[model samples]
Target: MAIRVTSEHDLIIEGGGMKIIDGRFGQPLYPSSPSTNHIVLLPENFLVSGTEQRISRRDFLSVLANVTRVMVRASYSTEPSAVYRLHSFSMQVANPSARGERRASAVEMCSCPPGYAGTSCEACIPGFRRVNGNLYNGVCEACHCHGHATQCHEVTGHCLDCSHHTTGPHCDTCLPGYYGNATRGSPADCQPCTCPLNLPSNNFSPTCHLGEEGELLCDQCQPGYTGPRCDRCSNGYYGKPVVPGGSCQPCDCHGNLDLSIPGSCDPSTGQCLRCRQGYGGAACDSCADGYYGDAITAKNCQPCQCHTNGSVYEVCNKETGQCPCKENVVGRQCDECMPNCWWDAERQECMPCHCSPHGSISQRCDVEGRCICRPGFVGRRCDLRRQGYERRETRRPVERVPIDTVQQRWGGPSRTGGCPRGAYRPKTGPLTHGITTGGQCVPCHCNSFGSKSFDCDETGQCRCQPGVTGPKCDRCSRGFFNFQEGGCTPCQCSHVGNNCDANTGQCICPPNAIGERCDRCAPNHWGHDITTGCKECGCSVIGSVTQQCNVNTGCCLCRDSFRGEKCNECQIGYRDFPQCTQCECNVSGSDSETCDMERGVCACADRTGKCSCKANVEGHNCGLL
Candidate 1:
């Protein structure tokens, strides 16, 4: 058992065995021993005090139990011991012990309630709180609803609904021109107010009302009208709504006639007769001068009909249709002219027949009726004939001949020196007489070198050099061959055969072969002329057009001048043998040169050398001379 001494009193108790005491007026202070390891004791009222100065035995026992429990708890909280040993002892209890034990005080355990946490169980759950100290046991007594407060709480302090013109959780007031009903929700419900058309209002709310004459409410006067009611004309009218005492009045043209004369209609006469000649209108405030069309019209006088021509009637004073002239002429109509001639004022004519200087011409009159002299011959009557007349002749100068005409005539070389090569002259009359050949008259020679310079006299044949050809060797080369004045020039590599054809430089390639160089042949042809530089072939065929022709095939592709199996004979158009040298003359009197023997026709030179004619009259071979 243990004893507890409080600040006010002390307590004692017995342990291991408990005893009870009965009171005359109340329940017993002691009960049976505590069945559990720990027990608690509390006063019914915290303000009450014990009657005795010391604690009762039961209370002291309760405090001992608490102290034991606290010790056991503390011991359990410590780390376990590392070493251990055991000792055993036995004793028999013949009689129950009546001894008391003392122990220290103990503490009580604490447990938090639902929705509350902390050592004292004082705080409420999340999202639920107490404000202004109005909550207990973690329970809220009041709570803010929706979104109406600046600071919402589950207890006490909370904001109410917002005002009509204010919104948001803090009751923020809306600005002018804005309105809303959103107190606890989103701001989407807010909106601004609008006013009617032409009836603007700065106030958020506007009301409608009736205007004068049942018109809608208006702000200001409209055009041409005035007054608050807007029911009267401004001015310039003779009516009621704008009477003298009202907002507007009728125009007093009489008193306000600062621009014109004033007059009025006569009631008794029933006519607008009381006005001046130039005044009219209700108060004679306008022009009535029969309007002469412009400001120049007189106030009371009639308009002057001035002529458009600025002649005749300068100004029509009377209302008559005819116009009168102010002076001679110079008016609207043809009514006047100068006083010089027969003055016809109505016709504005003044005929003055005057003669010009050259003659009595009626067409030369001046504006004043005077005549002018004609050009080149001047006189008043213009009838005088001038003196002096004669005929003259003009001629161009003739050129004279100079004495050096003889030298100019015989300018060129005589005879041989002036003669052209390849042309001949007879050794007769002119040569025998030894006349000097002058002025383009010169003898001709066949040799290009000189006359009779390279001649073959006895043989009567031209011994042409290697590069020279032609009858007299006048031409260095013949046919398709070319020369540079003296000797024949070699042919281009692409040209073949003895001479290129006159019209074209293409080779006369043998049959079964082709190409400008004669280096190619048709398929199936074989020959050394194309392969071995113009070598003769000894194939089985003597002269076949096909390569390696057999004896049975005979000749092929005969020479142009001949036609035979061995190319040994000429064709019908050819006359001579061997090379078939013969001429062929056409009906036009043109002839071909001697032909090649192996070909079918003559190989003639076209437009080149002289020819052996078919009907000769003189000179070479077939001639008659």
Candidate 2:
């Protein structure tokens, strides 16, 4: 098959025919001749594909070694049909039109073809620009006009009548909220004005118009609305209205038509001019009933609150709410209670009627100042207890009784009952008419732990339980045992803690004196007694062999040389030695001076021996000195 590198040159179509050209001039490497008709143009260091023809690597390299440039037409293959077919697949050259309608010869030079451009008419036109801009075997792409127009200006790329919302010369840009044509035509030229999804359709205008202001204006404003976009309510009007129809409502101003000044009221605020007499409020419609002061201002009124419900009529004076009083009730506004009924400021009205001293409840009575007494009480003022009525016990009430006759009655056994439990009656004279000062039965506050019984003696002393000896029986009794929190537990002294102090819980210590209960004597001390502290056993190094001494009595352990109980004195055998003096005798001598322990001396057998006697010379037994 023949390969046309360009319209000017064709690659020779022959068996295993291969070639290369100098890419710098884009021409054949060797001059074309009849024997070698085809040409191949390649850039420096180009890769060659030989699978199409099965050319060996060695043959392809040999052809690429020498590259040249030329402009010539030659025929290399004698098989014309295959060459023509190959040209149809890869390239197409046009035949020049005959001037006189004569048929053109096949041998005539081929002309540049349609849809092709460039010097050799081998490159696809601009509308079908090459992919990758490569001149060798590069595919061509048809120009995209963005669907706005069939074609675009070849060089400037300016498109005509860009599609909706699309703009730009190449129709490649989209308008805001629109998918096409962003740079051409007016902002809304191809854009359909739409309402925001959040805005209600009923209140918003039906259609949108985008004008020179570059703003979208609804076709018509709803009634009661006035604005460039008709999105806001007009003055004196409120609420969102339907498009081109509904209007806002004007403030009724409380419907005070007579007092309100015409056209003087604020449409939006509903505030009117000066209010009429006996009227107040933003609309001047509030009746100044039971009010006082200026009725024209917003804070015009003050309450009247008639005294004692004495107002002649329900409505009070126009200027102030103060009302005139009736003769029965007093005070400027007749707000005070009558003489019998005291005014209760906190309760804001006449309080309970003032009854006499013996009133049952807190001075509460009928309109009159009479007393209200309990069931058993009777009198004009409930001051006297009924003759036949007996006293009844009751818890102390919050209010004090005017006169407590029951509490002052005789304390001794009454004809009825004596006294309540936990209480005692005071002693009285035998059937005496007069009651004693201490007549009331009183309760004794004795501690439960101490008192054996709830009753108390006439002197008010509680009887204590066993093992409880305090005046209140609150502590352990002397010699009692087991002391704890419930009362005083006695000491478990075990004979050693005898006669213990009940309050301190300390028992008399044992004779040996030591332990907490004084049961035993401590280690080094001894000879303890109830009256005396333990004595320390004295053990001196000089008197005793070891520090250990007798634990029973205050005595030093003695050594062999020591004889006294405390080891301070020596034994009789060693009377003269402070530690332990032993008797000494002179065997050689036969004087009468016997061995003397106290002096550690033995006289010589006779006075003639000088060492036997102390100083003077003596006779035979030291009898004569």
Candidate 3:
């Protein structure tokens, strides 16, 4: 056995030898150099007493020397010939202790390798990123273009654009009432299938067909119809064209028949077969005698011939036998009198008779008549008076007596005691023999002389004084003026008298002055007398005074200080005056004396001084002042 030493500089050692010459020196033994040969051993075969463990192939190759040779012997079992065998071999030594040990650093184990990940260098395929982590447990994710989804990339997920009826997330579903194609990246179009009009569409799916079992089915009359198919008419059929949808049937006889009677009219013929006897027409509006029907039927009644005894009621119609009569008569024939008349059933007469004299014949008769005669008349006919005849002697007049003696003869109060103050009596009868007279002594009227001896007629009618009239001489005669003493007097001018003619009031006003008391004047005249009482200057114009006339021009009389025939207006340059006396301006000094009428300015005595000017003018002498 040979032991060889290797040099650090030698990468591959063959037939290796070790001798301490230079750092790169080698020696052999026997067939090789002594030093080199001993260090570098090569032999056919060798046996040793020391125990040596077998080396593994991997360990032996690690320490094998370059160019080292060895020999091995094998026995042949053939008897043909004994063979001497020379076997050549090489020797390689390795350290078996190095087995099951690691040579890499801890940092290298912790770091990820290029294009790999995780502690074990396990990662996704190239060009792909881990979705979760750097181990086989992680998922490989891919990147995708905008708006497009990737099929192989889960980490980057999917990118997709919404299709026609689909949207959101994975684009997995359709919109309401819409359905899309099944596949992705396709057009994904949607279809809509709504039900027909007047029908209900069912389900949310958009691909539904019209007659599908679960879809909406529409068939039938809209409303107000019937029958198995909803197309027939109801009880009261109504429509047009006489079809199944024709209009409803109208009531028979319509408005012409009465609804109160169930069989009033025939439904098929629409005619009234028979009306109640009192009734007529389709509506049965006829009335019987003495009764009337309303608009509805003739059988319906109203009273007729409503008039009293003397009055007649006329029939309104013969068929209905209805009569509208006069207010005073009533009954079927108007034969009976109203309660106001006397009904005489015996004669069948209504009498106008009343109580006796003013009323009818019955003791309790209500009628009225005239009376026989008045109370004062006593003859059978109430025309003649009773007679009586007798004779009497006449008497002669007697002589007069002194009133004083007659007064004494009365022995009571004087006969004049009851007479008025001015009344008197005349003596005509004898006193010594006591007066004998055929006529009775008469009373007398009162006189102005205080005598009561004047005579009066048997009726006491007195003769009036010269100017008096009236039974009592209480009033004056016509044309007389005085009212006292009940006598007349001459009328005075310009004064009215009570006894004068009513048309003229007795005074008789003078010419130009006229009134009840001569207090007023006629037009164009003034004053109270023909001279002073009346000034008639013919001032015919209105607002004119007597002085303004040609006959009396006292001052060319002005009205409201306006002097003119017409009195049209005030004079020029003057205002507010009975006479044109207001000066145009105030005189300030002797220099300014009078106001100039034309210019309305003061005339100045000294031409140099200021002038008293009218309103609107100023300066010396008011020259343009």
Candidate 4:
């Protein structure tokens, strides 16, 4: 590479073998021309041999910084010859086809090569990092960030903005939950690990890697699933992994079996070996044949209590314990007769007692079929009103209620056997509730100021606010203080601080800190840092303009004639620090001054009080030459 020595010139490229010619004139340089020799044409201000002797290093670098475009030949010769040009990786040059064959362009410039840039390929592009201390070079390679980053460090070539679970300077390392060759430089090189199947967040396996044969080997499986590939259920767990979208499920014996003992049920089918007492089934979820009531919850099953004479079957409903009764019979045990009917012992059936529906509390009568009467009505049918009781018009049979309001209340005894809509489960309730949308119960009167929200969990414990403590969130946490309505304020006493005052919320500040927050330097100090704290100004009391300094840099307010950060030294050509006396040496005869202000050193004329005397005449101050 050649650089111009002055502002009047530009850089030049060394032309050895192949080179580029002007497109307008290069087309005529065919091999069939009469002349074979080509004359050398040079750029403007080019130094011909025997014209200029040397070039300096400083002038060479100036050429590279502001290089102009390269130019083709200015030769006057008309002879045509086969010519070559500078070709980038993508640049293709094709000689004109034989005379009559379909013609083609002599040259085509697709684009600069991967790492090359500028008009004459004078520099590297953004995608490529500099190798020769940030300058033009042909050996630069494209940015290799393993497809995780588009840009790299300009000086170090370290990749930046790496994504897709990648890390390291070149983004060639895979993060957890991923595997494959991260250095391949392709987006698909690194892939997510899947022991059995892939999922967005949680997976059956926690650690996996590609095996020697390229098969996936899971190092460890998450709970609820087992096996080398996490393809099978663990002991006491059940699932159908043979089918699509199937995940392992726990045995869930519902407190019927001792969970502490392993292998309580079949891992594939979830069949329990035995039940606690009245519970029996695949998961011991229902009552046995001889038992009734809930077997899964409450576990309060009782023996069947059906009346032998009225009930049709020996067994009752296992859940609700309602027995199958004969016709015209009602009650839990199926022993009572229906309304408006009486039992006939001889016929083993019920007989109806027809009564006036308007005057009687009910249509039923005595066992002998004699109709009973209401208080205000008379006769066996009770159709007539008595003495002072006047008959009123009766609007019989009310209309049905709307279906929307006929829904059940959550956790009501008759509805869900739990709690009310506004109330949550009792404290210390078992398991997360799927019944409530929050998966936990919440109650009213929960602390709104100190808690995360006005809600308590199933165990009746309120969620504490951020940086809060105490059961009722009345106190600040370890790193916080000054608790009030909104919340507590965090301590900011720098890294050296241990604690703060609880009531006042004042930070315990470091020894070097002057501010309460420890965010700024002390008076006469600067450059406050968390680890090192504030550094002393250390300025010279006499040489400094003032005691003040830059807070972040600790740079002193130096006097006009002083140099150095602390203003302790005088400027060049000065004599003293505090006084900063200028050197009065004359360069014409005294030579250049090398003043050491601290020692009061300066090159005076003749190394004496006055100038040296010449061969003929002499005086002082070099008056005679």
> The CA-based lDDT of model 2 is what?
0.48
Model 4 spans > 4 angstroms off = 1-121, 125-128, 136-151, 160-168, 174-178, 184-188, 198-207, 211-214, 219-222, 255-262, 274-625
lDDT of each: 0.36, 0.48, 0.38, 0.59
The candidate with the higher lDDT, 2 or 3, is 2
- Candidate 4 per-residue lDDT, tens place, 1-625, comes to 1211112222233332212222122223333333232323223224422334233333333343444544423343333542434332222223433476655442233366777765445467766766665443435666788778878886678988888777888898877777877887777776787767676333677667777987777778867677667877776677865355777787788867545556667767787865666667877888877679877668787877888767898588987888888888888888777888877778876666667776566786645444545555544454544433444655542222222322321112211125443345554434456543334334534443355444444555555655577766678887676664334656544354536777786766655775667677778888776656787889889778878788878788877667788988876545444676655543333322343445543433322344333344334433345
In candidate 3 the C-alpha lDDT for residue 28 amounts to: 16
Query: Clashing pairs in model 4?
Result: 19-85
Model 2, range 493-594, lDDT digits (tens) per residue? 655535776656577674547677675677667776656657766665576765555666567767876656667765433444353545344323423344
Best-to-worst TM-score order: 4, 2, 3, 1
Worst 10-residue stretch by lDDT in candidate 4? 1-10
> How far does residue 194 in candidate 1 sit from its true spot (Å)?
8.4
Candidate 1, 575-619: lDDT as tens digits: 445545544523233233443334423333333323344544333
How do the predictions measure up, each by TM-score? 0.15, 0.25, 0.17, 0.27
Clashes of each: 30, 39, 76, 1
Model 3 scores a C-alpha lDDT of 0.38
- Give per-residue CA lDDT, model 3, range 1-625, as digits (tens): 2333322221222222321111122221122223212223212111121222333322232223233543222332233433333233343443324564654332224355454443444454443456775233455554332222333233544434544555445545444444434234454343443311112322212232223443332233344233332333332223331233233233332233444555455433335544444444443444444455463432345555544443454544644543454444455555544544445556555554332221122222111111122222112122211111111222521222234443342224334324432233334454455533333343454332111123343344455544455545555556444433213343334242323442333555566767666666665554444334566654324335543444334223545435465343344334433334333334433133345445544433322334456556665434353
Which ranges in model 1 have alpha carbons more than 4 Å from their true place?
1-121, 124-138, 148-150, 153-156, 160-178, 187-625
The lowest-lDDT stretch of 10 consecutive residues in candidate 3 is: 384-393
Report per-prediction Cα RMSD to one decimal: 49.0, 44.8, 46.9, 34.7
